[model samples]
Target: MKILYLSLRFPYPPFSGDKIRTYNILKHLSYKHSISFVSFMLSPDEKNQINKLQEFCKEVEIVEFSKLKAYSNCIIRSYSGEPFQISYWYSPEMQKKVDNLMEKDGFDLVHVQFFRMAQYIKKYTDRRKILDSGDSFWLNLSRRSKLDRGIVWPLLKLEASKVRIYETEIAKWFDQVTMVSPLDMQCLLSNDSNLPISVVPMGVDLDYFQPGSKSDDLNLLFTGTIRYFPNKDAILYFYNEIFPLIKESVPNVKFYVVGNSPPKNIQNLASNGDIVVTGRVEDVRPYFDNSAVFVCPLRSGSGMQAKILEAMAMGVPVVTTSMGVTAFDAFIDKDIMVADDPKLFANKVIQLLKDRELRQNIALNARHLVEEKYGWSSIVDRFDKIYENALANRS
Candidate 1:
């Protein structure tokens, strides 16, 4: 099958959640299908990564999108009903490239990566298109609006409303749509009753994140692009509200903030002795292996957090919010510890830190779960099916 893949970002160096998901699927699908990619490159570094993708993809084309241009586009579209996110990513170059590619190559199927790219191909009812929404974008924005209040509240609410409307409208255009979790699929179905949706879960590299028998120092870790709103909010919430409470109970506990491009506020958190912010690293698995517990205090966000899945795969017990565990229906006492309140979250972390036996038990269960259900090989097979089905249905 010749699959023309459309992505919002260049899925290379698979550091973030979306990149990892898209890149892994492509890596597997490329083995059997003639995969090509047309994606938006946010930085020059991503353009360089195009060569890396070319090793797997038959061809790779990227349209550069600068921060200033994206902001300008957002401002231009703000007055209109379109979601700011979709507008931010809108590019004439991308549209031109995609249009030319479709006309020339006659792709077996168009695999749209996110809601942002859906705008480009939504009008093409003549082609078989699969909309791979990493999550329910509408629900993500709605949750953001509820959590973020004050002067920006109205803006977030407006964006959420627009996202919901756009999501429903785009569903009608695509032959099939896919999301990371059943919860997101349900959200989509609730809004558009007749739209076809499928679940292709986020996969973890089990080989890289295998169970570590030896535990390191009593260090708790939270890792992601801290500049991202939800991650910034989550770390801040943990530092200000939860960490102090946990420290009272477990003074020896150390918190490590890993990942690249952390905000200044998060960087400043490193000034404290117990909190160490390592802004990006060559590898993250070592940190996951060394950590006693992986904490995800995400208050507002949707989708399966790759951080959680990575930690679980490394056989590290996770103490996270209910929002963090939405994708995986793992037992609270067995696979992970789910806590919503600050105190409860801290208590869970403290418990895991103090009880080695309990930690080992949960870590074993979590690793086993990922090996069985969330491994890259198994998860990518489901995606292969979706691609094959989309191609089969192509006109």
Candidate 2:
């Protein structure tokens, strides 16, 4: 099969949410399908990985996007009645390339990675179009608005409102659309009952994140790209509302905030010995191994938590909210322990720290869960079926 894969960002290094999903899917699907990638890149550093991607992709086109230009576009089109994301990524050059590709290549499918890129491909009816919206952007923005500041809050709400209308409107045009979690699929269905939506979840590299020897340090861990709204909110909520309660019970308890590009506020958290923020580490497996419990107290997010899956895959006991585990079909207290309340979340962590047997059981079950249901090969096979179904329904 031949696929024209459209990405908002060039998927390399696969560190962040959008990049991870796109890169993994390309790697897996490219083995069997001829994938031609068209995307944008911000930094020259990102181009280093083009060679790696070109190994699988038949052709790779990287559009140069600048921070200044993106912001300029954002302000210029804020009144265009479309979401800011859509405006920022709109490029006539890239659109011409896509239009030419469809005319010349005669690809089997047009696979777009996000709604931001949807504006470019939504009108392309010449091929079987599959929109892979990894998560519910509107739902996510709505949650972010709840915790946003005065002026920014209203802007976020406006964006969310626009996305709700935009996503539902565009859903009718695509042959099929995909989300990473069932909750997100529900969000899309709520918009349009008849829209075809499928759940193709984020997968973990099982062999890379295998079980390690548990450490004696009473360290609690949470890992994600620290600058992201979902992750930033989660760590702040944990530090301010939850960690103090745990500290009262277990005085020596330490929390490790692991991942990349933490802001000053997040970095300031490291001033106190209780919270240790590693801005950007090459690997996070050590944090998982040393942790007595992994906590994901995300206040607002619409899809699966990759950090939760990665820790669980590394055989780390996880304690997270109802929102945290919503994506996975994992059983509560069976595969992992769950609590929404700050006090309750702390108690779960303390309990796990004290009860080594229960901790190990959760870790073991979590590892088993991902191994069976969340590997890349298994997920790509599912995508294969969805592609076939989309083509079959194509008019």
Candidate 3:
């Protein structure tokens, strides 16, 4: 199949969840299908990475999006009904590129990566489009509104409303739409009942993340791009609400907040000794292997937590909130420890820290779950089927 894959960002380096998910799926699909990619490059460095992607994609086209231009567009559209996020990515150059490609070579299917890029293809409803929503953007925005406060709160609330309006209307333009988790799909269906939605889970590389032979001391780790609101909030929640409680019992225990672009608050937490914030490492598997527990205390976010899956695939025991476990179908006691409250979360982490047998059992179960369900090969196969279905329906 001649597939046109449209991405909101360049899926290179595969460091973060969004990029990793898109890159792995495209890598797998490239084996059985020919893919031509058109995506926005955030930096000049990303342009050089396009050569690396050429190994998988038959053709790759990346358009650099200037921060100044995107922000200006957002301000211009903020006055109107459109979501700032959608407007931020709006570029005539991208539309022109897509138009030029479609006019020159006919594609069997067009796979739009995220909601931000959905605007470019909404008018091209005549062609088969498989919209990968990634997550329900409206739902995420609405959740954010409740968490944000004061003046920023009203802005978030307004943006959330705009996102819902856009989502409901733009969804009608795609042949089919998919999200990372069943929970996200349900949220989308509830908001827009008529849209055809499916679940294509985020995948992990099990080989690189498999269980280690030895276990380290009771060290708790939380990994993500700390610049993101949900991740920053999660770490803040851990440091402020949960870690203090855990410290009373496990005085020697260490907490590592590992990721890129950590805020000053997170950096300050690192100064207090027990908490260490390693901003962006070349690899995260070693940290996962060395840690006694992986905790994701996410209060607000949509879709699956890829870090949880990565840790699970590494055979590391995990303790997370109900929000952290969002779209995954794994059993709580069998695969992980699920806790919504800070005290209970701290208790669970402490329990796993002391009980080696329990930790090993949960880690083994979690690894089994990922290998069977969340492995890259299996997840991408589902995407291939969805693409085939979209093309078949179009014909």
Candidate 4:
């Protein structure tokens, strides 16, 4: 198949969930398909990595987007009936590029990565599109608003309303759409009943994240891009609400917060002796290897949590919120544990920490689940069928 793929961000580095999913899926799909990818770069450094993506794309085109301009556009459009994310990524140069691409040798499929980038391609009525709005923006925004208070809260409430309408409105443009999980698919349906959507889960590099010997001390680990709002909130929730409860039960429990770009609040977590925030490690497997349990205290976020999947793939026992495990079909007690409240979540983590047998059982079960279902090769195979189905329906 020949695909014209568009993304909000460059798929290099594969650091964030969106990047990881796009990178891995396209990498695998490229083996059998031809792709013409056009995306935005946040920095000049990403320009150097175009060669990496060229391995998967028959042709790769990228434009540098200004962070200052993106934020400005986001705020400016926040008052209107449009998703702030959609406005943030709006660019004339990219629009012109897309116009030229569509006019040239036509693609078999046009796949747009996120709602943020949907504005660029959604208006093109002449071609069929597959939108990967993996993170249901409105649902995510709704959750985020409740977590916040006062001035920002009202703004978030307004944005959520705008996004809900925008998301529902844009659904009709795509020949088909896909999200990261069943839960997100459900969200999309609730907003727009007729929206064509499917779930193609985020996959893990199982071999790279394989299980290794854990450290001697009973420790808790959390891994994610600390720069993100949801992840920062999750870490803070774990530190402020959940950690005290766990410490009361196990006095010497160490919390290892590992990921890229630790914000001030996350960095503050390391001020205490028990918390260790390692900002931007080259490899995260070592932190997984040294932890007894992985906790994802996500107060608000939509779609799949990539960190949870990576931890599960590494054979680490996971205790997460109801939101955290929404992406998986894993059992509550068998494959992983779910707890929404701080006390309840703390108890689940403590149980895994205290009971070696329980931890091992959950870890092995979780690992088996990842190996059986969450491999990139298998995910791309599923997407191939979806692509065929889209083409058939279009004809």
Candidate 5:
């Protein structure tokens, strides 16, 4: 099959959730399908990494995006019905590039990475198209609107409303739609139950994140793009409400916040060194290698948390909230430890920290579960089938 793949960002480095999904899909699908990749790049440095993706894509095109201009576009269209995200990513040059490619390449199907990029192909009805909405933006914004306080909450509510309507209508333009989990699928259904949506679970690079020698130091780790609201909230919530409780029982326990681009507030938490904020590391496996437990205390977010899967794949015991495990199938107390309340969350972490035998059992169970279900090799086959089915129906 010849596929025209569109992404909001170039899938190189593969650090973030969307990039990881896109990069792996390209790698696995490229063997069976010829893919021509077109994506937006936020920095000039990204162009240098095209060679990495050339390994998977037959042809690659990267469109340079201006952050300043995108923000101006959003500000100009703020009063319009378009969602902030949709407006921010709108580029006339990108539209022109996609149009030229569609005209030149007789592709089998056009696979769009996110709804934000769906703008370029929504009008093309001559071919099969798949919109991977990733996580329902409406669900993510709605959760943020409620959990957030101050002036930004109103804007969040407004964006959520716009995204709910726009996302519902856009899915109708595609032949089929896909998301990371059932919870995200449900979010779209809540708006319009008739939209065609499928769940494709996220996966981890098992070889890259395999378990290593654990350090003797008691460490609790949370990893993600810290500047993201959900992650920012999770870290703050842990430090303010939960970390103190854990410290009472285990005074020497340390927390590590690993990821790129942490905001000022998050940076402040590392002042005394109880929390080590490694802004951006070349690799994350080292953090997972040294940690005894992985904590994902997300209060507001959509879709499955990839960080949790990576930690689980690395044979690290996980303590997370119900929100953290949504759409993830794992037995509590056996595969992982779950708690929502601050005290209970703290206790769960403390238990995992002190009891080496229990931690080992949970870690082993979690790793086995990941190997059985969440490996990318198994997950990408589902995409292959989706493409085949879509093309079959086209006939």
Candidate 6:
């Protein structure tokens, strides 16, 4: 198949969940399909990484994204009834490039990586179009409106309303629309019960994140892009409400915040030695190797937590909230430990830490679960089926 793949961000290095999903899908599909990749790059350094993607994509095109222009669009179109999520990514250059490609390329299928990029292909209806939205932006913004306060609260609330309407309507344009999990699919369904959408889970690189010997010390780990609101909220919630209870049980317990672009509040956590905030490590495998328990205390977020998948893939016992494991079919206490209450979450962590046998058992079960289902090779095969079904349904 000749596929035209469009993404909101360049999916190289695969630092974030969206990037990881897009990169692996393109890499795997490249073996059987002819893919032409076009995406927006946030920085010049990201442009240098195009060579990596060129290995898979027959043709690669990147446009440098302007945050200044994106913000201006949000402000100018604040009352245009367009969601800021979609407006922020609107670019004349990108539209022109996509239009040119669609007019001349005669591609078999058009695969859009995110809903933000959905606008570029709305007019081209001659071929099958797949929107890999990854997750519900409407659900994410709705959660944020309730959890977040301050001047931004009103904006979040308004944006959530706008996104709810836009997301429901825009998805209908695509032949097939997919999200990262059933939870997100349900969120969109709640808005429009007849909307056509399905789930395609996020997977981990098992080989790169192989299990390693763990240290005996009580160390809890959470890994994500800390600048993201959900991650920042999760870590802070754990530190303020749950970490105290865990420390009372295990006096020498330590917490590690591993990721890049941590906010001021998250960075301040490192002031006390117990919480070690390592911003932007080249590799996170060593931290996973030493971790006794991987905790994801996410109170709000749509879709699967990729870090949890990575931890499970690396044989680390996981204690996370219900939101963290929404994408997986793992058992509550066997494959992972789950708790929403502060005390209950702390107890789950302490239980895994104190009982060596329990930790090993959960870790082994979790690893087996990932090996059987969460590997990228197995996950990408689903795309071929989705593509076939999309093409079959053409009007």
Q: How many clashes (backbone N, Cα, C below 3 Å) per candidate?
A: 0, 0, 0, 0, 0, 0
Query: For model 4, how does the per-residue alpha-carbon lDDT over 1-395 read when each residue is reduced to its tens digit?
Result: 89999988897898889899889878988999999999998889999999999877899999889888879887777667576767788888889998899889678888888877778887777777888888788889899888877678887997788888887778778888888888778877987677888888888988778989877679889888888778889988889999999999999999998888998877886778899999988888888888999999898989998898899989899999899998897888999999998999999998998999999999999999999999888988888888898888879
lDDT of 5 by residue, 1-395 (tens): 89999999988889889999999989988989999999999888899999999988999998999999899999998888899999999999999999999999899899999999999998898789999889988999888888898799888988888999999999999888999999899889888898988999999989888989989889999999999999999999999999999999999999999999999999998997799999989999999989999999999989888999999999999999999988688999999999999999999999999999999999999999999999999999988888888888889
Q: lDDT values of the candidates? A: 0.88, 0.88, 0.87, 0.87, 0.92, 0.90
- The TM-scores, one per candidate, come to 0.96, 0.97, 0.98, 0.96, 0.98, 0.98
TM-score of 2: 0.97
Candidate 1 wrongly placed segments (more than 4 Å): 392-395
Better by TM-score, candidate 5 or 2 = 5
Q: Which scores greater on lDDT, model 2 or model 4?
A: 2
Measured on C-alpha atoms, candidate 1 has an lDDT of 0.88
Ranking by TM-score: 5, 6, 3, 2, 1, 4
| Candidate 4 lDDT for residue 197 | 86
lDDT string, candidate 1, 1-395, tens digits: 88899988888888899999888888888988898898888888887677889889999999988789889999887788788988889888889999899888977788889888998987778888888887987788788888788799998888888888888788878888888998888888898778889888898988887876666589999989888888989999999999999999989889999999998999898888889999989899888878999999999888899999999998899998888998996888899999999999999999999899999999999988888899888987887787677667763
Q: What would the C-alpha RMSD of candidate 4 be, to one decimal place?
A: 1.6
Q: Which ten residues in a row have the lowest lDDT in candidate 1?
A: 386-395
Query: Candidate 6 lDDT, tens digit per residue, 168-235?
Result: 89898999889889989988899888887988899988888888888887889999999999999999
Judging by lDDT, tell me the better candidate of 2 and 3.
Answer: 2
Q: Rank the candidates by lDDT, best first.
A: 5, 6, 2, 1, 3, 4
Best by lDDT: 5
User: Which pairs in model 6 have colliding backbones?
Assistant: none
Q: How displaced is residue 365 in candidate 4, in Å?
A: 0.3
